[model samples]
Target: MQETERLAEVRERIARAARVARRDLADVTLIAVSKTHAAETIVPLIEAGQRVFGENRVQEAEAKWPALAERYEDLQLHLVGQLQSNKAEAAVRLFDAIHSVDRPSLVDALARAIDREGRSPTLFVQVNIGDEPQKGGCAVAALPGLLDQARGAGLTIAGLMCVPPAGVEAAPYFALLAKLARDQGVPLLSMGMSDDFETAVTLGATHVRVGSALFGARA
Candidate 1:
């Protein structure tokens, strides 16, 4: 499908899913995950009214952000992948929100980077709800301490972000994330993706990152 048609179709899917979940369409924000696609593909989607986009790599984001920003000043870029502490500087410079901050060193680096840039973007602490050590997130048990530290450091802690375990059911993990968000007293819950966004929305997800569902295969 052409980009315009694809954009409309994705919006319709969001609306339909919201209806199925009995949630207001306005309450669910769609983030186009434009990670590996070229600028040519992204620009059409932007022109089609997709203001929010997601990128996985700090380096890739750093390279594309300048051009995207120049062409689409209203674009809101989100860093959706595991962010390394060393890449924090470039990540802060390019993204409007960082969704994978799961370590103290990463948080500290982000604080310093934001301080240097004089811009503090919204941050979401990635929680390894399934307790996957290989993942780059705090284990669920450690979230409170991390949340306290991030807040004490004056990082704009908007809410929690999580990626449910691939093989396991997503509902329980998502519910746990919602509980964590409530306990932390944060409002935003960035969860859900193409396959399970309806469940995420039903569980109070404020933002759903949909890529393949919208843009088809990642080229």
Candidate 2:
């Protein structure tokens, strides 16, 4: 399928999902994950009114930012992949929202970078809802305290983020994230992806990150 067609299909799917969940499509922002894809592939989506784009690597985002941001001044860049502390400065300068903040050290690094760069991006604390040690997220048990610390460090705590275990139903994990967000009094729930985002929406995800479903399989 063509990229424009794929983008439309993905937008339609998100609208349908929102309708099924009884939400206005506008409430559910579709973040097109642009990791590994080049500027050529993403520009078409931008032309089609896809304002929000996600990138995983700081270096890749840096390479793409100068060119893209120059053309689309209102573009909202999101760091949806796991971020390293060393790349915090680049991240703060480029990304408008960060999805993977698993470690407190990285959070502090982000705070310093944001201060140095004079940027304020919404921050999400990544929680390993499935408790997979291999994954880069804080355990569910540690969320409240970590959130408190993040708030104290002058970061605007937007909400919680998580990627559930593959092959298992994602709704429970989504529910857990939503409840945790509510418990913390945070409003946004950044769960869901291309495959199981509808489930995530039903469970109260305010924002859904979808790439493959939108742009077709990434090369």
Candidate 3:
């Protein structure tokens, strides 16, 4: 399928999922993950009216977004990968939202960066929902503390983000993330990906990051 065709399909799927959940379609934001893809591939989607995108690396986004941002109005770039503390300032300046804040040290870095740059991107604290050792999110038990630190540092905590274990059902993890968001007085939830975004939307995901479904398999 063509990129525009795929964009239409994903939007339709999101609308259907929202309708089934009795949620307004406007509540869910679709973020097309553009990491690993070239600008030539991304521009077509932009021209097709896709405004929100997610990238995995600061350097990669820096290389492409500056020029793209100049041409496109209201383009929202998001950092959806694990962020290194050293890159906090660059991430703050470039992304409109960040989905991988998980530790106190990183929070401190972001706070300082925001102060210096005078720009605050929407922030989500990623949780190790499945307790995967190799993952980059904060442990479940450490959530409260991490949140406190983020809030204390004057960061606007948008909500929580999580990546469920691959090749398994993602509903439970999405549900748990929702519950955690509620418990912590957060109003947004960023969860879901190419394979399970519909499920994520049904379970109260306010944002879904979809890549392969829209861009085709990455090389």
The residue pairs that clash in candidate 3, if any, are: none
For candidate 1, which ten residues in a row score worst on lDDT?
Answer: 9-18
Worst 10 residues of 2 by lDDT: 9-18
The models' CA-based lDDT, in order, is 0.86, 0.87, 0.96
RMSD, each candidate, Å? 1.5, 1.1, 0.6
Model 1 stretches with alpha carbons more than 4 Å out: none
Clashing pairs counted in every model: 0, 0, 0
lDDT tens digits, residues 68-128, model 1?
Answer: 7987768898999999898888888888998998989988998899989998888999999
Q: What TM-score does each of the candidates earn?
A: 0.93, 0.96, 0.99
Tell me the spans in candidate 2 whose CA falls farther than 4 Å from its real position. Answer: none
lDDT of 3 by residue, 1-219 (tens): 989999999999999999999999999999999999999999889999999999999999999999999989999999999999999999999999999999988999999999999999999999999999999999989999999989999999998999999999999999999999999999989999999999999999999999999999985
Distance from true location, Cα of 105 in model 1, Å: 0.5
Which TM-score value belongs to model 3? 0.99
Task: Name the best candidate (by TM-score).
Answer: 3
Residue 179, candidate 1: alpha-carbon lDDT: 97
Candidate 2 C-alpha lDDT tens digits along 18-120: 8888886777888889888889999898898889888888899999877899888799998998999999998888889998988889989998998999988
